[model samples]
Target chain A: MKLEDATPIIQLGEHLLVSMQGDLDDRAVLQLESDITRSVSETQATGVLLELSGLTIIDSFIARVIARLAGMIRLLGAEVVVVGIQPAVAITLLELGIGMQHLRTALNAADGMALLHEIRE
Target chain B: MVLAIESPESVCSIDSEASLVTVRARVRATAVDLGFGIVDQTKLVTAASELARNVLRYAQRGRMIIEELDNGDRRGVRVTFEDSGPGIADVELALRDGYTTGDSLGIGLPGAKRLVDELTIDSRPGQGTTVVITAWDS
Candidate 1:
């Protein structure tokens, strides 16, 4: 289907909190790529917090986009921290060859926000 | 010890996954089950997904065959996706990355070939297209 509605929420503080909502599939991934790239470029926050708690499935195309987004944020001199990755999403990411290495991942949004707070510290 | 399983039986025929956001997640399960390693899973899955999507979009309907070979310690998987639609008019341009017949980044065919061990494409202007992919563990 549409995979998921790509409404990237940006909460500006010392960092940016972007929560993704949708099924992370090939059909809707490219658009997310464009949106994330635009959001990061437009708002040069210290770090970007991506909350995937709303996601149900994490396809490979979406996985690649996640990897690329982390890399892109690094290129822009900002760090990317992921939060609320569902257990299913986590399993899929691992299976798809996505390493949690070099990327910061938290169990829930609260932890992610805390990590962001720590990073700002 | 080469085990040969004919077409249609070898491929993973899943539809909705093509459109799922976490499509890559299924790649490792499919690849490992097909006898590939965790390291090779991503490349194979991505490559296979590209070809599978092509079949769905271009051919409207088709079947994929994923043949895995495991003989005397050698392990690998071969994928053959066949479509009965109008075949490629220009295989050369189609193989070039970013050259898409549809709205993709056009990294489907060429990228798939590059990600694997062996690739053989058989297609004609009106007949159809057959993509044969083989990944070997060395």
Candidate 2:
């Protein structure tokens, strides 16, 4: 099978922006580790913003990865925020208890950015 | 190197989707015996439970296929699950983490694929879904 790709983007700002595309498969998860590590390191962002609008599902394994990512970002003196999570996706994440620790979620990008701004002050 | 290992006992032929977590515990521990970590085992078991539960909930009945790699090159397991349910409307949309026909959290396939090294999904609207998952420890 062809390995799933990770569509991650990094920008310089108060919030580190990263988006994941394609299936969040094991390979993709592994790739995300390196991508996040690099992106979080080079950016001056104090918070991490995740856009899950493109993601339609939320498996437990992926939730674990997200939890781990959140922990990793916190170690860098930053926090993680999730956006565009559908109701069903949110339910699954809740079941897996993925983001119970210091996770801030938003209904849209605007809300996510606003939350970031709120945290900055 | 063809590492083909099969366990007939690992097959859980239940139709209750709500009982999935119980089965997950059973299967994950078995998979762990085959050289998987606690985290990896939990992921695989959870993924399997979600997939199998879909079968029970949507299709009402199905079979779970479990296979492990004996290849000297690597240590892994493959599970091919088949269900004769109402079928998926849109595979791409369904592949998304939140798109669900039922009231589930809609993370079964997406989450399952993420937990394993390899994932293959084939389904039709009325035919059913055949999901193949591969987990590796190598």
Candidate 3:
């Protein structure tokens, strides 16, 4: 799959927002990871918000990848906040025992950005 | 080449990460076509994904079947995954949460079981493994 197939990352000032829409294959996830990591340096963004409200499924692979992505972004000096996880996805993650403790989460994009601002300040 | 079954449903081969993607998409679409809601669709699709990934990671290649199920007034989607790799040595231990033989999160088996209405696993050490999952409309 092309890089375009993955959701685009929107830049709002110093923070970047990536909202996932439908089910993403492993390729798309890897593409997004490389794209976002590159954007972190190219745009010099201080925070990144991953919006997962549109995704209903959070398989073990995807969850593991997201966790690794968060770590990569942090190494690039940007805080990552995952937002808008559905109830089902949340339950699935909990049952899977993948709390993603290293990453922060928000109820929605607005709150996620707010939390980002708090972390930055 | 992608193989097509003569029946109403179809089976896809999972040999690479790319094929796993195809299986996931096909299962999700099949669940939706069977009139499953978003939540149920997600569950089945997720379950399929985990199992398919296992096949690629462990067995090198496998086959997945996606078919519609009808039981009088109830309708559901059923998916079967078969792999001819080193079978599980401990089925009971593998079914329990937090028991992973590989370097994974240990959620593929137990997590999949919770997501669907029915799950059956048959395996013989050094032979192969097969998993069947069924989710009914609520």
Candidate 4:
């Protein structure tokens, strides 16, 4: 499936919300990193909500991509918040030693949006 | 070629990014069939993803084998990843978190180890690498 179809970027007010659903391969995740970065720059968004509740697994490679994507978004002057990480996925990530210490996360999309707005304000 | 298993419960070829997804799905399904809990299933699938990607990144191509194990009252799943790419020069260093020979976080091997109950790696420079991991249902 196409990257855009699997994970679409929606503009919400001054922010971009991407709900990543289904199975995303390595290439798709990499494509998403670039897509989100470019979208942030083009739209001049103030914040980004990356919803990952649809994803069942987040391995090391995907975790690295998320971290890098967050950093890139911040460089573009946009706040990014990851939302809806499944409990099992979170446990696996911690066990894998990927704490994602620098990235901001929320329990769900609504809370993530609030967190992003808080950061912007 | 790596040592061949007489019969693996399932086998998935690792040749591209798509194959990584396939391997994860296959492993997850096998885990479910073997009655692995949600947490255990997620851990096994994630580890399979990391290892499958490693095969593509380093070896260019490889294969994954899933086997169902029965030990008296216990049931488990075993996954083996084999690649004919340039083997790891320092297996010890490779297992260390944040030590990547490539442009990565360098936690695939070690992280995969932590997810499963047991993990072992065999590699020979200029030869190939084989990693085996097992998780038991408790």
The DockQ values of the predictions, listed in order, are 0.17, 0.04, 0.53, 0.86
Name the regions of candidate 2 deviating beyond 4 angstroms.
A1-98, A101-121
TM-score-wise, the better of 1 and 4 is 4
lDDT of 4 at A40: 97
Candidate 4 clashes between residue pairs 3 or more apart in a chain or in different chains = none
Indicate the residue-level lDDT of B103 in model 4.
70
Q: Write the per-residue lDDT of candidate 1 for residues B1-138, one digit (tens) a residue.
A: 588655543445535545322234444455767666544665666666667777777877666665667775777777777878799988888887668778655666776777678878888878889888888775
Q: Which structure among the candidates has the greatest TM-score?
A: 4
Q: What share of the true interface contacts does each candidate keep?
A: 0.13, 0.04, 0.49, 0.96
- The best-first sequence of candidates by DockQ reads 4, 3, 1, 2
Q: Looking at model 4 chain A, which ten-residue stretch has the lowest summed lDDT?
A: A1-10
**Model 1 compared with the native: what TM-score?**
0.58
Model 4 residue runs over 4 Å out of place are A2-5, B1-9
- Tens digits of per-residue lDDT for model 2 on B1-138? 867777777676656633454456556666777887655665666667667767776888877767777678767878877888878777788778777787665677676666667778788878887878887874
Better of 3 and 4 by TM-score: 4
Error at B16, model 2, angstroms:
1.1
Name the runs in model 3 displaced over 4 angstroms.
A54-56, A95-97, B1-9
Q: Compared with the true structure, what per-residue lDDT tens digits does model 1 show for residues A1-121?
A: 4424756557577577878775445545666667776776787777888887886545444666787888987788777789887765465455434456777988887788788778867
The better candidate by TM-score, 2 or 3, is 3
Each model's lDDT: 0.68, 0.69, 0.85, 0.88
Tens digits of per-residue lDDT, candidate 3, B35-74, equal: 8877777778888888999888879999998777777677
